[model samples]
Target: MARIRGYVEALIAELRALDDGDVWMLGGGRLQAAFLERGALDDIEIYVMPEIIGGGVPLFPATGLRLSPKLIETKALDKGCVYLRYNFS
Candidate 1:
């Protein structure tokens, strides 16, 4: 497992070259939003924490950009955390 950090295009190219199973984006919601906005991601796995907080960062921060990801799978974890998997359509 190698971690590549550089230009987004470079990372996308490397990932495409690898063509291995699923590529996971650990965090950085801004970066994730950018990738999704640029059509560089195939699927997204979002972990929802059961809580209500004020003034938190938004997941999809791109202005005026909307994405409707198809539901692929969902897993309910302990402590009220739910994992939702969606594929870009």
Candidate 2:
């Protein structure tokens, strides 16, 4: 996988200029939240495990922000993993 390391603002600026292809942001909930807030996120794809771990990081934190995503697709993978795809409308 290719990687680019830079300040958050620079990274988001570069991401905003892309007109084609998919950009995948790995991990870092804070960064993801920033991108979502800046209108840089197109779709959110997540993998859900069966077991519940206590005190895990929140996907959408409490900032009075709301997103209405349409459920586009779902897949049940091996080892009780569920893949969900949501299109932000």
How well does each candidate superpose onto the true structure, as a TM-score? 0.76, 0.75
Clashing pairs in 1: none
Q: Which regions in candidate 1 have their CA more than 4 angstroms from the true location?
A: 1-6, 19-21
- Worst lDDT run of 10 residues, candidate 1, spans 1-10
Kindly list the per-residue Cα lDDT of model 1 for residues 1-89, writing each as its tens digit: 12333577687778879957777777677678767767988888889997787678777665687878899999999999999999996
Candidate 2 regions with alpha-carbon error over 4 angstroms: 1-6, 18-20
Best candidate (score: TM-score): 1
In candidate 2, the residue pairs with backbone N, CA or C atoms under 3 Å apart (3 or more residues apart, or in different chains) clash, namely: none
lDDT agreement with native, every candidate: 0.78, 0.76
In candidate 2 the C-alpha lDDT for residue 15 amounts to 68
On a 0 to 100 scale, what is the lDDT of residue 3 in model 1?
36
lDDT of 2 by residue, 1-89 (tens): 02332466678887679897788878666666667766778888889887776667677666666788889999999999999998875
Worst 10 residues of 2 by lDDT: 1-10
